[model samples]
Target chain A: MAETGTSAARSDAWGVWGGNPPRNRGRQPGELETDQLTIAGEQLPSRLILGTGGATSHAALEAAIRASGTGLVTVALRRLDPGAPSLLDVVERCGVRVLPNTAGCYTATEAVRLAHLAREAFDTAWVKLEVIGDEETLLPDAVELVTAAERLVEDGFTVLPYTTDDPIIAQRLADAGCAAVMPLGAPIGSGLGIRNPHNIALIRQKVTVPVILDAGIGTASDAALAMELGCDGVLLASAVTRAEHPARMAEAMRLAVDAGRLAHAAGRIPRRLYATASSPTGGLPW
Target chain B: MQLVVNAVTADVDDAATIADVVRDLAGIAEPRGVAVALNGAVVPKASWAETRPADGDTIDVLTAVQGG
Candidate 1:
């Protein structure tokens, strides 16, 4: 953890190779599934959470989400029109759980109001509470973030703050009683990929609740990297929705998330600056 | 001008405020995710109250889209 004030953008320099995720062998020699990622005390089935706001068309958005196979998806209460491609109809048909978001809010008061509104609209307390401090950066206002989290918790809302990967900020958000605290791998909508795996790893290690890596993902590799770093889940949208082939990309994301989780459990080798021999025992064995 | 209001256009006064522009063009009760831009530059969300529009300004006011 390098502490505060990190570079805003994280370019993908990480090395990764992909394969079908390893199967979890239970004690009885049967496969076990890692289901229901619990954040802030709420259990959700899908690791690949989708966003409902950005597709070119309603049908397109619905197709991408269905292809993604997401059990938990996000929708906002404010921007939703009761008419015009209504979310309720799509959400009903998709048959996935909903996690409403509080976007465009700059103050705790407004954020809190939106959470209640989302709860009323979707009948779910889970929310992605984003209280932005800077319009250019879209960074979470840590001060207002905690303030709003505290309020939401009091009202029994599952508050998830979209925050930077600052340990202090993470600590504060978790302490404020957020269901889970989501730290960006990089700036939202930048398509820059994960910038600081170290910071995200640190946040995961420190937080008692699940630490979800949300936003700034460009491809499946980024999602895998987050899982390998021990993040409980991933919240994504553009990586699939914006893809030339969203359905295929959605399936790819699902595999990547599973692969990353299995690899974490499989135990990774320590990283070294220089190449090391994997086997010193190899000496022309006949 | 074949203007686009919420991606659809209307014939309204060129000097309308952003609030007026949206209220007139959108016909929707509330304008959400509507980030106003003049041609390319993003107008601050806070400034929608005081900012006025002019003809040929090429306004691009987009709603808060969630996904890609």
Candidate 2:
């Protein structure tokens, strides 16, 4: 397939991988110029990845999706009527890419099976591999997650495994050929933002693959903090969908992600043991 | 013939295809955005008409739902 101008530019942003050179050929006028978030050789314009769950109404969900300006949105498969107002219809209407997730599966087999089903349903090879180990914590089972990631990678799916903040597991998933590794900030939907920022940073430092901070984001600050910690993206659901004003929160999260990305790129000042004056003392004293 | 669809037992014709089962369970002529699995394997859309559910076989019809 011939590469688009945008994708070619993205390939330039991230050097070519796996023997295929990054395509950098086209330039467009007046496009929103920003650093690219390349996942599986694809450039996603927005750093904020939105979730489709927990919206009180379809209107609210649609509004939030629009407000967020996210390039990717996550949806989970469940045993339900296919004729209903499926989330697929909504996301399709919005024109952003849909990422089907294996939300409730516990075993590698279950997650893999669901991923195939989602592939058939969504006609997309991308799967957010989530293997929940514990019911209470909703924590990812690292062992099963690696197994599933390996299997899906072999199956030619773009496997983005949802893993823990542990750097070892993060490395394992990347080694398993996952497109990206998503480490939870905290338990899913706990509103507990970035329980271990250091661990997330460690994972970022350890893996070459993109690190997406998934779950447990309470609000805009949490999303910002994730990006500031060098996360490629943020995957969250309840933080926006379950809020009293979801649309407003969606806009805030969008802005926060941009703000954090800019801040991280601009670089931060070093922590000081003593107070360092922002203004020059000699000039002020005179 | 009896079949368990989404864990609900339902009676259908002996040679019922996955498409038929989906339409029946959803109570709609056209079931949109639904994917089917017979037993433990997904039945692709192209094979839906050819694949028939046998007795004691489980059929799972899934669609996009609100989840994280």
Which candidate wins on TM-score? 2
**Candidate 2, TM-score vs. the true structure?**
0.88
Question: Model 1 chain A, poorest ten-residue lDDT window?
Answer: A10-19
Instruction: Tell me model 2's lDDT, rounded to 2 decimals.
Output: 0.86
Cα deviation of A21, candidate 1, in Å: 11
lDDT digits (tens) for residues A150-249 of candidate 1: 9988888878789889978898888888878899998876767899999999999898878889989889999999999999888888777777766557
lDDT of 2 by residue, A1-286 (tens): 1111325654575443112222233433323245778999999978888988898777788778877878899989989864457676678777889899999999999999999999988889999999999899999999999999999999999998889999999999999899999999999989999999999999999999999999999999999999999998899999999987787678778878877877787799998899987787786555
- Per candidate, the number of residue pairs that clash is 8, 2
Question: Which runs of model 1 end up more than 4 angstroms from their true locations?
Answer: A1-32, A79-83, A278-286, B1-68
Residue A17 in model 2: lDDT: 17
TM-score attained by model 1: 0.71
Name the candidate that leads on lDDT: 2
lDDT of 1 by residue, B1-68 (tens): 33555444566665667667656555763454344555545556566667876665666544323432
Error of 1 at A128 (Å): 1.0
